[model samples]
Target: MADENAVIVNVLDLPIEWRHNITPYHEVRDPDLVQQLRASMEAHGWQGPPLVCDRDLYEVNQDQAYTGSHRIVAWALAQDDPSADMPCVFIQDIGEHYSIDLGELVEENFGNTYAAVEQFVALLPSDVAEAYGLDNG
Candidate 1:
């Protein structure tokens, strides 16, 4: 659980260096979606803070995001001000009892929803697929 007293920080101040790859595979970027998000943010502003976890228990003093990566990216791409501040909810002092394994967490969070798999497969070269043994047909 996060501390009830979490403070808002500048988006540039976010500890992105400590970020973990919480997704099982790369997600294809959608320019249209990015544009939509940008327009939304420009018109309505930020809806909420991104959820950030304290990595101090994992021997790192930085915070990592277990969620809201896309929102963060959208903010970066959309915001005109480089030093723009955004609200962030920080999970304070999480220890082993509250720890989640990365792989399991990714699986639980994303659930293998490869909605763009066909699009991805279409872009792969045949020799590349065969090299990776992914040439099913």
Candidate 2:
């Protein structure tokens, strides 16, 4: 059960304070990211909670927000009777609040996959090395 005090608002009613921070991550590869998500949502409904963190806890000067926030807001915007409200979870207290470094999270998520590629290359048989311009010697 969720706490009665835990704030849950419609996707439309979300104020600037709650949403001004969230950042959306989109890729050119995701051609229908905006369309598909909204379409599926119309048929069904939102299955996930907004990724929120305490505002008063950490003071990040140059910070970015959690990924996919725009989509959540967009989904709200497309509704016929859109309220644009969404849940905003906050840490209870200044001392007890927990949040992660957004920069680190982004770096981790978007880190280069060179290591994986190297591993795949290492697995290739030496017999094919000459064919692929490799000299295992």
In model 1, the runs with Cα more than 4 Å from the true position are 1-29, 55-62, 81-83, 93-137
lDDT of 1 by residue, 49-124 (tens): 4434334434554344433545545555556643334444333211121342333433554643232222333344
lDDT of 2 at 107: 53
Q: State the displacement of the C-alpha of residue 49, model 2, in Å, after optimal TM-score superposition.
A: 3.1
Please name the candidate that would achieve the greatest TM-score relative to the true structure: 1
lDDT of each: 0.40, 0.37
In angstroms, the error of model 1 at 117 is 25
RMSD values for the candidates in order, in angstroms, are 14.2, 15.1
